[model samples]
Target: MKNLKLAAAIAAAVSCGPALAQTEIVWWHAHGGQLGETVNSIAEQFNASQSEIVLTPVFKGGYEDTLTATIAAFRAGEQPNIVQVFDAGAATIIGAQGAVIPAEDLMTQAGVEFDANNYISGVRYFYADSEGKMVGMPFNSSTPILYYNIAALEKAGVEPPKTWEEFESIAPAIVDAGYIPLAQSHSPWIWTENFHSRHNLPFASNNNGFDGSDGTKILVNNDAIKMHFSKVKEWLDKGWYAYYGAGWGDNQTPFENSEVAMWLGSSGSFGGLLNSVDFEFSATYLPYWEAITSEPTQTFIGGAALFALTGHSDEENKATAEFFKFLSSTDVQKFWHKETGYVPITTAAYEAAKAEGYYDEKPQAEIGIKQLSLPSGDNSKGYRMGFYVQIRDVMNREYGRIFAGETDVESAFNVIEEEGNKLLDRFSKTN
Candidate 1:
């Protein structure tokens, strides 16, 4: 058995005449709680499987903190060999000249077997460069999907709506029936970024920054965007919608507690909801604009990937790349998909799991594959916008004002578009 072989490998190395010198590779990650345990377990198993390498995965708080620490370490010449970064930080990492070793390049340099085509379309595209080459290892990627309360929809005498127009038509009745129609997490993600993209609208002037991040103008001040905010503000006014305030946990709590009948959240949240909620639920495609009714389009991947940090020794770099290959192996992909709610990155792993009736048991998971595999478009391939964090802050705070009735929808959007553009402009000049 592989387990027995791995144990023997460890034991033999420990008791050998000339003790094997292990090549140490450190990984900085963003996961905590049960996710931390998964990382730790994987590292242990990998260490046991080989005598020459010891992969050490260290949790470094949340996504932003992990990125900050990694950058700080790089400046101090103490960066980890590998660092997990969220999708929002992709452009930032790529913009860091000579500070990150492209993951694909690292794999080849370390002579690790790798195939870019093995990864899922959505996961790979989000982490890829302009040349359609994967610049980082795709790991734990997710996308936003609609989560509807089955019982609540049934009681309202309607199935889950497929479009935003239909969702609005059914909203009032759900509210009248004493159920919260929708609980949206606070961010420009679902409401603005993912929403505009799913409907096939561009977020910037340069094809959503796929061309490049420089000189990118914010093109979001359009009729569709205005319509979106106007409707959202209206829903907030009528008490039919709720936005998750301040924390990631706030959105799902309302849905789990049955305070809201409809929710839009990260697909990665599915496992948590399944464990916490007593009620029946189903995940479905993100709602599209009625104008996009000709055909459903793709949504963006929402989670993160692992990037190889720069300024490390040749030995450390080689070990990190080896560990990356280990993680990308089909076995580990299946393990990650099964353990966490995150979908498998590899096509092989996905098919293997599907053949075993894994997704059949949970119909909601099918949404992820379908959404991720849809044809690439300006919106679907994923945004590489610079200054994304700053843009998000502007969108979040200004939109929060719109939701809280502190400003009219038009005024708030005007400010968000103007401020976000400035941040983009500033980032372009500097980068």
Candidate 2:
């Protein structure tokens, strides 16, 4: 009788083996630090809420590093099921025809009622086809805003600038008061975004890549941008600004530490800034160049989106789609936005949070939502181009040259246009 019992137990164990194994989905991403923790927490929550799947969140370094690693992995047939690509990498992923599965189609096939109307127009437009089919899921979306140390400003007896002219005027006074007037990173990508937005200029032709196949190249040499860079150089010379090295996360430290009075950084920096600062801080809309226009245009959103990979079976794809739907639900989006300082992707999530007084309790958090909701013109929606990551590197190099006094503004811009255009051409052709 004991031998018969042992045989029955073995048979039961064998029968339950496959049922006990959960479907593991790997998510490759560029998030780290607090944002990384948030990603893991979301994955944990999802895993606990379901029995069929488990998501593993893996940090693959910064944005550029993550994209490079993903490409290498894909070539080796070892790519993860999902990867987070930033706005700049949108065109590259779209160009990878056989490599990606559109998220809209995936969700539909999974039997989830995925509705495009649920998402904000700006967020959806960035990741969708011309026909409004979503290519990826919007994750951590944000816009650039002016972060100010209110205490520092009060100490200097200067009000936060409401216009570009006022912003420039206060620079000298802040420095005279022995404070860093501006804490801009030495990285050019941030400046590129700032300059384009301030001047309300198109970074590239074809509505920054949403318009046409033959997109043209434009850079910082335009009159409005030239004037902006020249002003920055002047600030640098007057000791009004200090350059933090091109380290990915070091730039915001000065602002958080209250060493600098003002900074222009992503709205997503809200959480970290809030946690680290003891002094009073406030967020306002990004200042615009007074010469460019009278009003502020919508600033582009930064942060990453989740792209579904090709080559998975229909069942696997369906599972991935289910996960995407899970992510898009109003509950998940509100949780993500509230916890991570990322802007909500859906209008419903935004309105829901507002009704719950989420923004009233956290005033600084409202800046991003206000900035993204402003009317979008050609200049506002953000830039999308193949090889944008590489082009940004080139811009950074040229800006360093200018900062080092190796070249003047015009000369450096000339090099930027030349190098940047070459890269754009290469990516355009290959893509």
Q: Which one is best on TM-score?
A: 1
Q: How close is candidate 1 to the true structure, as a TM-score?
A: 0.94
Model 2 lDDT at residue 96:
80
Assess every candidate by TM-score. Answer: 0.94, 0.89
lDDT of 2 by residue, 1-431 (tens): 64664465446545657766556788998989878888887886676566667678899998879988999999999899999998778888877878889988888878888788888866776777655588879898987788899877877789988777897788777877767988765345456765575456778776666553355575556777777777777777877777675664677888877778998787888887788889888888877776778776776677788999997777667778878888887888999999989999988899999999988888889888887777777676566677777777777777767767778888878887888788777877785
Model 2 misplaced stretches (Cα beyond 4 Å): 1-23, 130-132, 211-215
For every candidate in turn, the CA RMSD to the true structure comes to 2.5, 5.3
Q: Relative to the true structure, how large is the alpha-carbon lDDT of every model?
A: 0.82, 0.78
Q: With candidate 1 superimposed using the best TM-score fit, by how many Å does residue 402's alpha carbon deviate from the native?
A: 1.0
Model 2 clash count equals 0
Model 2 weakest 10-residue run by lDDT: 211-220
